[model samples]
Target: MKYPVTVYGDPLLRKKAKAIEKDHPKLDEIIENMWETMYYSDGVGLAAPQVGLSIRLFVIDASSGADEEPELEGFKKVFINPEIIETKGDEWTMNEGCLSLPEIREDVSRHDEVTIKYLDENFVEHTETYKGFAGRVIQHEYDHLEGILFVDYLSPLRKRLLKGKLIAISKGKVRPHYRIKVPK
Candidate 1:
């Protein structure tokens, strides 16, 4: 089943997610649903919080058809109880968008590489390092687990400029290509 993506106004999006146990009930099913919902929403990544589940889980598939980022090709993976061990290298700016934030996109600066420890769908633990677009995607999704939006990285002036637009999104005034659940 595909879950409706939660909009920015949802309080759950602002809450830090909790880590799930290895024996989390229906873990596999939830991961499957996340993938389905992500594809339906045409997002490269989706955090559990984006679906109104305050759990430490996310899914990513950065296979661009145009081979724009070759490193991201076939980079599908499921992250459960993920922890960023370290972030290294220089910071670079990239335009980032979120399933929860809808039409808003902004250039956020992030490290060029990241080392993360996480569990897979089967509860298998692994530590991996990613670079370039893959690292950016991971960092973006990881922020969701910590209740941090990309907009938070923007300057005060930039944030102020976009305040109205952000409020509009929170109020469900924006139209995204995919389905979203707005706060009542």
Candidate 2:
């Protein structure tokens, strides 16, 4: 079953997610459901926290952008208990959106390259290096596990400018294409 995406202002989204053990129950089913929710929401990536589960898990399938980013064709990954071992290269800015924030989109700055250690769906360890678009996507989803949002990377003035919209989102005043769970 697809889970509702957790909206902004929900405390769970702000909390640092926990690590998932190898023996975590029904992990495959949960991951499968996450994929369903992501595609249904028209998102290329989905973090466990976005679904109201504070676990260090996320999935990415950037194939939809293959037209513009040829390297992204057939690029899919599952990162569990991920750890960023290194981030190199100059920071780059990119427009980003989040399911939790609904219509909110922001230009966020992030490292151009990164190396991370993580577990796969089968709990096998993998240390990988990524650059450009792939690295950016990885960093974005990784931020969710660390209780950070892309909006947090904006300048203070920019954040102030978006305060009202952010407030509206927190208050469940916006309608998104996907189901969402707002703070009580």
Candidate 3:
């Protein structure tokens, strides 16, 4: 199923997500639906909150071509209740965008490599290290689980200039009836 993506300024996008308690009836279905929604939208990642779900879940597949590396193949990954256990090295700046924010893209600084601990789709625990573009995608999707958007990293001046546009987006002026609601 292709779920609706909440746009910028949606209250649900600002609220931190709650951790998934256990393997539930619709968990697997939701993951599958999210992947379908993400691929349909040409997004590298999709968080539960983006689809108006408040659970701490997100999907990432960074197997796309990067500016530095063009021949990279993508991989599909799902992170449930994920945490960055370790991060090393200096920050790298990359132009980042979000599915929720539509066409907006901004330069954001993130760690070049990270080690993350997360629960997989089958409820198995795993820890893996990622570098380069994969690392960036992980960090980006992880931020969504915490209610952080890529625009939050923008400069104060730029943010101020974009405030009206963001507000209009949130209010559904630009894309009416497309916003999804977070389940209470």
Among the numbered candidates, top lDDT falls to 2
Question: lDDT of each model, Cα atoms only?
Answer: 0.91, 0.92, 0.81
TM-scores of the candidates are 0.95, 0.97, 0.88
Native-vs-model 2 lDDT?
0.92
Q: In model 3, what is the error at residue 39, expressed in angstroms?
A: 0.8
Better of 1 and 2 by TM-score: 2
In model 2, how large is the Cα lDDT of residue 106? 84
Q: Best TM-score goes to which candidate?
A: 2
Q: 23-64, model 2: which lDDT tens digit per residue?
A: 898999999999999999999899999998999999999887
lDDT of 3 by residue, 1-184 (tens): 8898878877788888988866566998999999988888888889999998888899987777555665346567889999889888789999887878765678899888899999998778999998888888888888888889988888899999888877766665564333343222
TM-score of 1: 0.95
Q: Which digits, one per residue and each the tens of the lDDT, describe model 1 over residues 7-95?
A: 88788888999999988888889999999999998899999999989999999887762277676767889999999999999999988
Per-residue error (Å), model 2, residue 125: 0.8
What local lDDT does model 3 show for residue 105? 72
Where does candidate 3 stray beyond 4 Å? 66-74, 175-184
Query: By descending TM-score, how would the candidates be arranged?
Result: 2, 1, 3
| Better lDDT candidate (1, 2) | 2
Please state the error at residue 44 of candidate 3 in Å: 0.6
Q: Give the Å shift of residue 168 in candidate 1.
A: 0.8
Candidate 2 weakest lDDT stretch, 10 residues: 62-71
